[model samples]
Structures are given as C-alpha cells and as structure tokens.
Target: MAEDQLMTYAVGEQMNLMALLKNVTVRVAKNGKQYLDLTFEDRSGEITGKFWDASEADVERYQAGRVVRLTGKRETYQGSPQVKIVSLRLANADEPHEPGDFMIHAPMKTAEMEEELNQVIFEITNQVWNRIVRSLIAKHRDEFFSFPAAKRNHHAFEGGLAYHTLSILKLAHSVTSQYPNLNAPLLYAGAILHDLGKVTELSGPVSTQYTAQGNLIGHISLVDGEIVAACQELKLDVNSEDVVLLRHMVLAHHGLLEYGSPVRPRLLEAEVLHQLDELDASIMMMTNALDKTTPGNFGERLFAMDGRSFYRPSEGLTGKVDPEK
Candidate 1:
C-alpha cells in the first residue's frame, strides 16, 4: 500500500492491507471459545482487532512479528479506533513488505544519535562517572539502541530508549546552564544512564514486551544492581560518594515512592534528573496525541497525564500576549 493510504480508511469502511502483527494474544470469551487479540501496525500507527472463534492452527499462524494481510472494517470501540477483523492471512513469500518495514523508530538517525551521545559522554568530566557510564554503555550498546523505552506510552519505538535518554540530556544541558549551581556532569551522567535499565526491562524492538525481571524487580532496581556489579568489575569502591550518588539518580528518577522510586530525590542533580525525565516524557506523549488531533480540537485523554486531553489551537493564533502600553 502507498504510504498515504496507510490508516486513512474512514470509520466503518472496510480495508484490506498488509500490516505487521505487532502483538497477538489468545483470549477466552465468555462463550468458552478462544479468540486472538491482535495489534496491527504500519508506518502510520497501530490498531487493535479481535479474531473470534480462533483455532489452535490460527493461533500458531498469526504469531507476532510476522506480516499479514488482513481484511477488516475501521471501527470505534469505546471511543478508540480499532478493527473488526473479517479475515486475516499470513503474507505470501513473494510479498514485498516485511516486519521491519512497519516498525516505528526514533526520529534521529542512529549515527547522529551516536555522535551526540559521545559528545555528552565527553562532558562527564568526573573520572569515576565517566568510566562507569562508558563501560555500561559499551557493554549494552546494541540493546540500548535497539530496545523500546516501554512496551507502550511515550517513546515506545525502535531505539526509543537511547532517543529518550538523549532528549533528557538536551534538557539537562539548558537547565544546568541557567542554574549554574547544578552539577552539569552529574545531571548529564544521570540522564544518560537513568533509563539504561529499560534495555533489560523490555524485550527487543519486535513485538516489545516486559521481561520477567522488568515485571518483578523493575528497571530502576535492575539498573542500580548493574551499577553495583560494574563497580565490582571495574575495581571501584561501590561505597564511594560518587557511586552512591549515581545510583541514587536512577533509583529516585521516578520521583516518588508510590511511582516506583525507592527513594525521593534528595540531591539537587537527582531532583533535576527526575523533573527533566518527566518533562521530556510528558512532551512526547502530548505531542503524539496532538499530531493526530485536528486543529482547534482537544486530543484523546492521556492516561499518563492524569487522563487529561490537550487542545491543538487553530493555526495563526498568536500565543504571545500584548505588552501593556
């Protein structure tokens, strides 16, 4: 299908197109019959669908990470767009499209991201922090750049983990410049390494899911463990103030105990890291919703943002206020 044609079907319109099987789960209905809960994706976006009365063979054939041709109707279920699957079949061997063709990716190019990351690392003048960050990043380099920051929500795409990190670093740079008292190196290092745990937290890019460790131990604690292990391997004292502070950055990034942070942000840099992380993620979520919303309308309610919907003002409205004469 042409790029323009992707996801352009009007509600109730029937569509037959190739899409990547982003996710597939066997679900049991009240009637005691099994069905496939499916998520289909193309470059445009994703939609959920239901394939009812599925057989064992159907489950095996419609696995995630494969491209399939599906016939379905565009629909609204509880205010969200989904598909009512009429039929679905695996793509033929001769089909031109592949799973990679439908995978979403970070906006920045990999080379550009790498170069920018290296520049940020160079700014981590603290010797211990520099070595630790360099070592962990080098060790998990591929996964760090390939895994999604999450299974869903903000920055959930190929290389999203790294992209989100870089975004926070950019924000931290400006914040540190204006506040001068904030330690630039500490904030930068925290930003780079804060979500590094997500590489371990989430499975690879294709059909992303949370791993057992992610569900149980969680990313913050997992990364803190990694920092401790790295210290052991690198022969650095884990008890040192530098190591403790670095660990605290990751542990307190979620901002509160209820939100998964084991501790609150006691350090100024840790507080800044937490705030910047929230700021970047909030911006991404709101921007994504606004992109799909028509001008002068409110977008969908964002669950991550207290179930609030944002408005996209019509073009040509001056956002600036006139100064008093």
Candidate 2:
C-alpha cells in the first residue's frame, strides 16, 4: 500500500487527507440546520472542520476516535485555519496510514522517562511507602506510559502521563532538597501516584476522551481507591500514618474541594504536592500557549487559564554565546 499523503492544506486548497477524527460534535444552527463540527489531526497538527447539512447517519458513521478520509476546502475562520468539508468517510481497512501518524507524543522517550521514575522510586528509603508506590506504578506501567494525563487539558498527548509525573517528580525533588524539613519519600510517593488513576480514567493516548469511570469517579478518588486496595493486597494496615498521609496527598493534590479534591490539603507534604502539581501544570499550559504564539504577540485566550493570554517577546537578549555576531 502506498503511504497516505501528508496533510499540508493551504488556504483554498482542496484537501483529501486521511487523518484521525478528533472531537466531534453535532449541533443545530440558528436556522435549525444540523451540522457536524469536528477536528482532524495527524502528527503535523489539528484543524477544525465543519460538515453542513449533515445527517444522523453521518454523525453515527464519523464519530470521534475514528480514522477518516476527508475531502475539504481549506479556509480561515477567526484568523485560524479550518476546513469546509465536501465529503468524508470512515477509512477503509486497507488504509495505509499507521495510527502513530495521527497522534501527538511527548518529546522525551518513554523508556528514558520510565527509567527516571524508577530512579526516583528507588531513592525512597521508607520500605513500606516505597513498596506501596512501586507496586502501584509497576501494576500500571504500560498504561502509565501510554495514557495522556488528560482528555483535552494539559499533558494530553501520547506518553503524557509519565511525562507529567516525571516532570513533577523532578520539581518535587528540587523543592525538597532546598527545604530539608520536607519529607522526600512522601513527596516522591505522592508525585508518582497522584495521577495513577488517569490510566483508567482516559480512553487512550490518541483522540483522547474520558472513560465512563473517569466521568463518574474522576482520577483523584479513583487513585485514592487504588492506594487503599494496594494496602489490602500487601497486608499492610490502611490506618497506618504513612498510608493515611499518602492517601491524603492523592486526595488533596487538587488543592480544593471545588477542583475535585475531596479534602483541602492539610499536611505540609500534601500542601507541597498540590503546589508542585499546580506549578508544573501551569508551566506546561503556559509553554504550550507560548509555542502557538507568534514571537512578540499575545497568545490565544486560554480557557483553562482563566481566559488569560501569554506573551512571547521578540526582543533579542544576550545568551552565553551570540550567534548573530
């Protein structure tokens, strides 16, 4: 089979691209016309698409998560690229494009990140806590490496769960080193297991969406339940202080009840976990926005960040070595 052509549609270009159907929504316009609004993405990037006068059959056939062949005319909407769909169909089985071609992925290698996480866990001296953390991680290592941290929010890419966890672990380590009073084992345990339930919460890495369990239970409580189960399986006392504090960190890492944390952070390590998680997520969101911005311009409004826009300065500054000299 021949390789599918890359999706590189210019404005007004007629595109016949085979790509993954991302988020799909069917809505009625003001004129009472039903249409399909969708996102199409390959490894290159994503673009919005609309199929006007769409029928119910179309909605059922080209639902989100399916790979499809789209015929559309590229156009601009609100300064962003979009497609006016002419026709589309579910990709045939013989479709040459690999699934990996349609998904976004983390910058770092999964094995490298996993090794880093293993190192962090191996450093924990508290045997009970170390066993608990290591057990949970080992049980879900495959999904942990493949699942995104979220469906649409930050770290929503292949290998994102591990990437996000490892990034937080590094931040937590640096923080604990500076504040000698902070508990390194507790922080490391919290960092590794805080988002463990995300493995079950999300559908998969590509064209990610929340699972039924995710929608009903959520990652925080889901992971808390896992910790409790691990305690039982290991014949450890759930009521022990170490177990309680570790569970507390997972439950309270969101930092507030309104944000899905059942309890506000009460322990110092729990508080630090919440802060580090927030800090890492915020930086990822900001950096993602910055990447999209033209140098010297404000970024698109970030709904997740309270509709704030980030700035990317174009001004030249000194580096250790100047390239333009």
TM-score of each: 0.92, 0.88
Highest lDDT: give the candidate number.
1
Give one digit per residue, the lDDT tens place, for model 1 in 53-161.
Answer: 9999999899989999888788866445689998899889988457888888998888888899999999999999999999999999999888888887799889899
Model 1 vs. true fold: TM: 0.92
**Tens-digit lDDT string for candidate 2 (226-287):** 99999999999999998998999899999989899999999999999999898888888887
Count of clashing residue pairs in every prediction: 0, 0
lDDT of candidates 1 onward, in order: 0.88, 0.84
Q: Model 1's lDDT to the true fold?
A: 0.88
Model 2 misplaced stretches (Cα beyond 4 Å):
1-16, 71-81, 84-87, 92-95, 315-325
User: Model 1 Cα displacement at 233 (Å)?
Assistant: 1.6
List pairs with backbone clashes in candidate 1.
none
TM-score of 2: 0.88
